[model samples]
Target: MTEQHGSDTGPRYAARRRRGGIVSFVVGLVATLAFFAFFPGMPHVIDWGAVLASLAVGALARAGCRAWMAKEAEKEGKRIGHF
Candidate 1:
């Protein structure tokens, strides 16, 4: 006897996750850049390497936020094709 499986949700979930990740990254990057640009004291407080490191950290944070949001969306059955 053959066992039938239901719909495969992985691709849909991943697509949504990727889209959310990109949006989050863009927003976070912009905010970070603006903050650095507008805060006069910030330049003196951080070196070039530190600034680069912070940017990397911000990227990771954005990715994490996106992943969390995607997971939450998946839990709520918010798959891309569903809506």
Candidate 2:
């Protein structure tokens, strides 16, 4: 008797989820920035320095997430295949 093996979905699912999340994050970020740019003096206030800081933080966050996922893939014995 042969044992039935399940199809692999981990890589595909993870990639899809990551792509969707990044796209949504980027879109939301752009929208928020545009809103602030257009209505700079609308209310409480808007600080350009804060905007730059947020962008820097986002960059660092993205890098960290990528590094973590890469390590996970390595542990799973998956090759870091080229896009």
What lDDT score goes with residue 17 in model 2? Answer: 42
lDDT for every model? 0.62, 0.57
What's the lDDT for candidate 2? 0.57
TM-score, per-candidate, Cα-based: 0.53, 0.51
List where candidate 2 sits over 4 angstroms from the true fold.
Answer: 1-44
User: Model 1 over residues 1-83: C-alpha lDDT tens digits?
Assistant: 53223243457555656777677776766666666667876664545665675577668867687767756766766543322
Look at candidate 2 and give me any clashing residue pairs.
Answer: none
Worst 10 residues of 2 by lDDT: 1-10
Clashes of 1: 0
User: How does residue 19 of candidate 2 score in lDDT?
Assistant: 77
